[model samples]
Every structure is written in structure tokens, then in C-alpha cells.
Target: MMTTYLERASHALALVCRVVAGIALVALLAVTIADVSTRYLYRLTEGAIALRVTGSVELVSYLMLCSLLAAMAANVEKSQVVVEAFSHGLAPAIKNRLHGVYLLGFAALGLVLFLGLVDSAQSAAGHGEVTQDLRLPMSPIYYAAAALSLLLGVRSLIEALLGALFGRDAEVSHGE
Candidate 1:
């Protein structure tokens, strides 16, 4: 009963994350398109006068990066694309064991990503790098990406571990 509750809660969280991330991605795309159009229109209106355009591209890049980070976390949760081609022939117990091994691997990956996050944060601090136009410390964005990646890794590990320990319903929808 506890497992079921946890699973349901995790699924709910994934759904919310997915919706928010998807909206951000769409908004970023629209913003990028608008920026391009605006710049082109400005060039035409200005007529051979080059205006020193400053931050739109940088802003767009940061927004896109953030969207990508969010999307990745959502993708890991809605992991539907499993390779069961050979697993079909295996016994149930063996399949569960194999899945457990996979979960361990995912946990290891999570550890690696967590370590990378530390390194990235330290490097950013040492360099004092900031965005060209926004002047925001680039370290924070890197840290955000690292944190999201770690979250994704943890989600995968949890799914794999749960499936291995309690088995999984093949019919359960992996929808975020």
C-alpha cells in the first residue's frame, strides 16, 4: 500500500513537471521566432544603419537551455521505450534481477552527475563568468542543469528499483 502511494505521488509530480516544462519549451520557441522577426524588421526599417543589438540571443539561449533541462527530467520519468525483446524469453525472476542491475547502474550514473554538478559549480565560481548581456552569473544556470540531471537520474533509479523489487504492471502508462 505504501509503495502504491509513493508511485502515485511520483507519477503526479512527473505530470506536473511535464506540463510546466512543455509550456516553457513552447514559450522559448515562440520568443526565439519573435526575436528573429523583430531583428529582421528592424534591419529593414533602419535601412543600412546597423543597430548594436545586445541581449536577445543570449537571453534566448539561456531560456532554451533551461527548457532543455526541464524536459530531460520529464523524459526520464515517462520512460516508456524499454527494450524487452530478449526479456520476453526470460523467466520472471530473472527479468526482475536484470532490472535490479539496471537500477544499480542508474544509481551510479546519478552519483556521477552529482559529482559533475559540484565541479561545474566550483569552476563557475572560480572563473566568475557571467552572461554577456544579462550579466547574470553563468554558474547558477549550470548548477540548475546539473541539479535537473541529477533529478532525472534519481527518477530512473527509483523506477527501476521499484520494478525490480515489486515487479511492474506492463499496462501501467508511463505518461508524464
Candidate 2:
């Protein structure tokens, strides 16, 4: 069967999110290693190197948050936890409809989170919120998080609709 534009878009979005999340994780790892190495060098050289990363803590924290939010969409799409005890006895059609309802509910929750994040981003921007160490603006991170939430929301909605229309077969697969 031919793929829909929405499916293509969802796939693209998931790919992008996963890629970003991977990059963020790598960056976090690299930063942590660098920070630890610097600290060790400082201790060994008795302040000769003196090359402490001034904002390493704040930078790592931001990277962690970014990695988490960036992975959210792909996780929601592909790795949702299932309770087989609750679904094992149901007919496939019933199970699928239940899944659809669950997806829709998730989508609604995502939408609420997205809106709240947007508001928080705006407030942070207005207040000129910044990291104490780096003085990095917080609004951009919030905005990125809001965008990821929106992406998850839309992807969930689309999956829900497909499930409603096509039953079990319409459910999104990890292969996509």
C-alpha cells in the first residue's frame, strides 16, 4: 500500500528527534568526560592547567533536558509500555480500539503539556531567565521542548485516527 503524507511526515519527525537526541547524548557524554578530565588535571597539576569548565554543571543539565525531550516523540511512537494482563483476553478489535482511545488520551495530555510549555517559554523570555553560570537564555530550550511535545501530540492523534479507521492493522509499527 502507498504511504500517506502524514505518515511520511511523522517518520521524518521521528527520525529528526531521534537524531537530535543521539547527538545531545553524545555531547553530554563528551562534556562530562571533559569536565572530569579537567578536574583531574587541575588536582594533579596544582592549578597549573586551571582549565575548569565554568558552566559545565548548567551545560550538562540543559543537554540532559534536551536529550530527554528530543527522545519523547520517538519513545511515544515506538516504545509505549503495554500491560498484557489487561489486554490479553480481549479480541484484537477491542484491544485495538482500546489502544486508540489510549493514544487519543495521550495526545490530549501532550497538547496540554505543549501549551503549558509555550506559556512557560513566553514567561521565561519576558523575564529574561538565564542560567546563572553561562547566562544562557532558557526560553529556547523551553520552545524546543514545546515543539517536541506538539510533535508527539500530532503523531499520537494521527495514530489514534488510523487505529480508529483501520483497526489493529492500522497501528503504527516500529518498522516505519
Candidate 3:
């Protein structure tokens, strides 16, 4: 019963991350279009409109960061890529064990990234870092990314455990 609840919660969290990623993608597209249009109009009118979107580069960078971070959980859960070239001839049980090891390694990497981001966030906060044009605090973005990294780590670890215990069957059933 507890495992079922945890699985549900994990699924919900992954769904939320996917939704946020979609929203971030839309925002990124809109911002890029607006920035391009503004630049084009400014060039065409010879600065008559005076409508160049300031801080557009910074905004796009933030949007991209957010989009990537938000997508991590779902991407980790989904196993979007499969390299069967080497593992194709391997026994099913061996392949599953190797996959489990791979997931565990991924989890470890995510944990390292999460720790690095936390340190970066703290350093940014201490230094009062801000974007050049918008003066947006950099620490918050770092912290958000850190949170997502932690989530990805946890999800990866969970998937690794399941893969180890139930092999490929677990992954197929859990959509991992």
C-alpha cells in the first residue's frame, strides 16, 4: 500500500514537471517571437517605434533553464532514449541489471549536480547577483534548478531500485 501511494505521488510529480516544461516552452517561444519582431520593427522604422525588448537574451536564458529543469523529472521517468546496439544480444536479465546500474549512476550524477547548484545558489545569494537588464535575482533560479535536480535524483534512485528488484518488467509496468 505504501509503495502504491509513493508511486502515485511520484507519477503526479512527474506530470507536474511535464506541465511546467510545456508552459516554459510556450513562454520561450513567445518571448523569442516578440524579441525578433521588435528587432525587425526597430530596424524597419529606423528606431521610430523605439521598441526593442530589453533583457530579452537574459529572459530567454532563464526560460531555457527553467524549461530544461522542469523537463528533467519526466525525462528521467520516461527513459526517452535506448541504445540497443550493445545490449541487443545480451540476456534479458543481464540487460535489466545493466540498466539498473545505469540508472543508479544517473542518480549519483544528479545528486552531484544538485549539490553544485545549491552551492552556486548560496554563492549567488551572498554576492547579490542579478541579471544585467532586469536585475532578477539569480539565486532563485539556481535554487529552482537545484530543487529539480534533487527531484530527478530521487526519481532516478527509485527507478534504479525498482529495476534492480523486478528487472525490465518493473520498468514496463511503471512506464519508466
Candidate 4:
């Protein structure tokens, strides 16, 4: 019963990650297109593209950052690579306990990374760095990406923990 619930919840979260990744990719593409078009228009005219492309071009970095984070989340949710050779040889009970311990360690590591990201965001904000033309703060975007990465790490930890506690949804094989 608990396994069923956890699997369903994990599936739902994975779906959400897919949607977010798709949206971020689309947004990045649109921004890139705009940047290109503006640059071309400026080339056709005088060398006045700086005014049109300055601030908007800078946003490309943020958009790309977002896309990468979203894609990473989706990947982690859907398919995580692991070396199963050792686990396959282990007894079922031992395998479950080992998996549980691994997930707990990963969760602890994620917590540390989350704290570091938060601190970095705070330090960046305190420094008051702004975009060249738009004067928009960059810390927010960094923090958002960091938060997404943290969420992905946490979600993976949860999935692993659940699988370790309950029997995994998939059949276990001694062979690859």
C-alpha cells in the first residue's frame, strides 16, 4: 500500500519535472531567436545593436541556466544511472538496507549543498551586482536555479528511500 502511494507520487513529480524542462527549453529558444533577430537588424543598419541587444542578451545566460537545471531535474527523476553489479549479488534484505543507507547519505549531502547555495545567494545579493544595462539583480536567477537543483536532489533521495523501505516497483535481477 505504501509502495503504491510512493510510486504514484514519484511518477507525478516526474511528470511535473518534464513539463518544467519543456517550458524552460522553449523560453530559452525564444530568447535566443530574439537575440539573433535583433543582432541581424542592427547589422543591416549601423552598428547600433548594443542598445537593442545589451540587456536582453544577458538574459540568455539566465535562461540557459534555467533550462539546464530543469533538464537535470527531469533526468534525475526519470532515469538515474547506477552501478548495480554489486547490488545484484547481494541478498534482497541486505540490498534494501544498503540502498536505504545510500539514500540517507545522499540526502545529507543534498542538505549541505542546499545550505551552501543559500549562503552563496545571500553573499551575491549583499554584493549588489546588477546587469549592465537593465540593472536587474542576478542573484534571484542563481538562487532559483540552485533551488531547483536542490529540489531535484531531494526528490531523488526520497524516491531512493521509498524504494529501499518498500520493495522496489521493478523486478530485481541478479544479471544486468
Candidate 5:
């Protein structure tokens, strides 16, 4: 029952994050288009209109970063690349445990990322750091990334524990 609940709750969270990631990607596309079009328009006008999207590069980088970070937790499980050749012959119960171990590994990775992002954000905050082009504060971006990393770690950990404790809802398939 506990595993079931965890699975459902985590699934919902992943769905929401997936939407956020999608929106970020769309925004990235729009920004790129605007930047390029403005550049082209300026050239077409022979410098008549001094129009350019400033900080576009920085904005792209930030959007890409946020999109990827938002996606990590949502896609971690199904995106794992594992060789299933040996596990093909293993019993169902053993396979489940192996999957649990894999999930735990993901949790550990997320924890590492969370620690690093948080540390960097703190350092940036202390130093009053900002992006080179946009002059936007860096700490908030780092904090948001750190929060997402934390979600990845916690959700992965919960799924790991769920897979280990109960095998009914925990299914693992690699390259299938």
C-alpha cells in the first residue's frame, strides 16, 4: 500500500515537471527565433534599425539548463541504459531487486548533483555573482536547479525502496 501511494505521488510530480520542461523548451525555441530574426532584420535594413536581442545567449543557456534539470527527475527511471543480457535469465524477484539497486544508484547521483548545485549557489550568492551577459542573479537559478536535483534524489530513493519492498508495481525493463 505504501509503495503504491509513493508510486502514484511520484508519478504525478514527474508529470508536472515534464510539463515545465516542455514549456522551457518552447521558450528556448521562441527566444532563439526572435534573436535570429532580429539579427537578420538588422542586416536586411543595412543597419538602419539597430535592433538586437541582448542577453540572448545567456537566456538560451539558462533556459536549456532549466529544461534539462526539470526533466531529470521525470525521465530518470525509463531513461536508464542498462544491459539486460545477463538479467534476462534471472528470476522475476531477482530482477526486481536489481532494478531497485539501479534506482538507488540514480538516487545517489541526484544527491551528488543536489549537493554540488547547492554549494555553487551558496558561493555565488555570497560573491554577488551574476550572468556575464544578462547580469541576472545566478543564485536563484542554482537554487532552482538544486531543488529539482533534490526532487530527483528523493523520488528515486522512494522508488528504490518501493521496488525493493514490494515488487508488484515496480517493473524494470531495459531496452524493451
Candidate 6:
């Protein structure tokens, strides 16, 4: 199939999101390991070793959010929990149309999330709010989340448009 420019762009963005998500997961794992190890050692030493990862909770929370948000752009269509038993009787074209409508709703949801993140980022910037425990600026994190949300919206919108225009009935594969 001849892919459109929008599809190409979305694919590239998915690649980027995948890389970032992987990084976030790795970072999260490292932080968790370090925190657990230090806490264990501190307990064993009976206050002799007063060393523990400060704000590990904050770090994990941020990384977890980033990883999940980063993954949405790539997996929105591919990772849906499809229940075909109810729609099994529908014609293929109708199924395709219904799926397109579902995708449209998902796109709208992503757009709304994007807007909310941007607004929160603006408010955080104005108030100079930082995260609890770790004093990391919240605005930047919100902006990053906003970008991911926008990417998800665009990817979903493009997929919906393509599916509707091409009438993808036979090409629906719920596989990565």
C-alpha cells in the first residue's frame, strides 16, 4: 500500500516515542533498584549508613507517567482491547466504520488531554510550582506530557482519516 506523508510522519513519531518510553522505563527501573537497595542497607546497618535515594517516589512517579504517556502515540490503535463477540454479526464495512468512529473518539480524548496538560503547564509556570520531594519544575514535565498527548491526537486523527477514506475492512489486524 502506498503510505501517505501523514502516515510516514506518524511512524517516525512513533519511533521517537518508543525510544523515549524505553529510556523512561530503564530510568524507572534504575531508580527503583537504587532506592530499594539503599533502604535495605540502611535498615541492615541500623542507622550506620544514613544513605537512601531522596525523593525516589517523586522520580518514579514522573518516570512512570512519562513512560505511559510516551507509549500512547504508538499503541493507540494497535493495543486496544477489542471485543468482537458483540460486533461479530456486523458486516466488515460496518465494523470498519464503527472502528473509525472509535478512533475518532480516541483522537478527541487525546486532544482534550493535550489541552489540559498545556493549561496545567501554563499555570505551573506562572506559579513556579515544582514537584513534591524533588523540587523539579513541574511546567517542563507538563509540557513534555502535552507534546506526547498532541502526538497521540495527531496519530489517531491520521489513522481515523485513512481508515475512513480507504474503507479498511479487510486490513484490520489487531497485531503489532
Query: After aligning candidate 5 to the native by TM-score, how far in Å is the CA of 123 from where it should be?
Result: 1.5
Candidate 3: misplaced stretches above 4 Å? 1-3, 78-85, 91-93, 168-171, 174-176
lDDT of 2 by residue, 52-143 (tens): 87799888998897788778776665544569999889787776667667788769977998999999999999999987898989899889
Q: Tens digit of lDDT per residue, candidate 6, span 103-149?
A: 78879988999999999999999999999898999999999999888
lDDT of each: 0.66, 0.77, 0.78, 0.65, 0.80, 0.80
Q: What's the lDDT of the predicted structure labeled candidate 4?
A: 0.65
Which pairs clash in model 4? none
Stretches of candidate 1 exceeding 4 Å from the true structure: 46-53, 77-85, 91-100, 170-176
Clashes of each: 0, 0, 0, 0, 0, 0
Best by TM-score: 5
Model 5 regions lying over 4 Å from their true place:
168-176
Query: Listing every candidate in turn, what is its Cα RMSD in Å to the true structure after a full C-alpha superposition?
Result: 3.5, 2.3, 2.4, 4.7, 2.8, 2.5
Q: Please, what are the lDDT tens digits per residue for candidate 4 over residues 1-176?
A: 77667666656655676677788778778877887887888787788655355666667777776776666555443343446877768776666556655555555655676777788788779998776768987678668777767766765676676656664532242111
lDDT of 5 at 105: 87
Better of 1 and 3 by lDDT: 3
- Candidate 2 has its poorest 10 consecutive residues by lDDT at 165-174
Candidate 3: minimum summed lDDT over ten consecutive residues — where? 165-174
**How many backbone overlaps does candidate 1 show?**
0
Question: Which model, 2 or 4, shows the larger lDDT?
Answer: 2
By TM-score, how accurate is candidate 4?
0.71
- Tens-digit per-residue lDDT, 1-176, candidate 3: 64565566667767787888898889999989999999899889999987877888888898888788778766674663557898779887777666667788778977998999999999999999997899999899899888888878877777666566556433465565
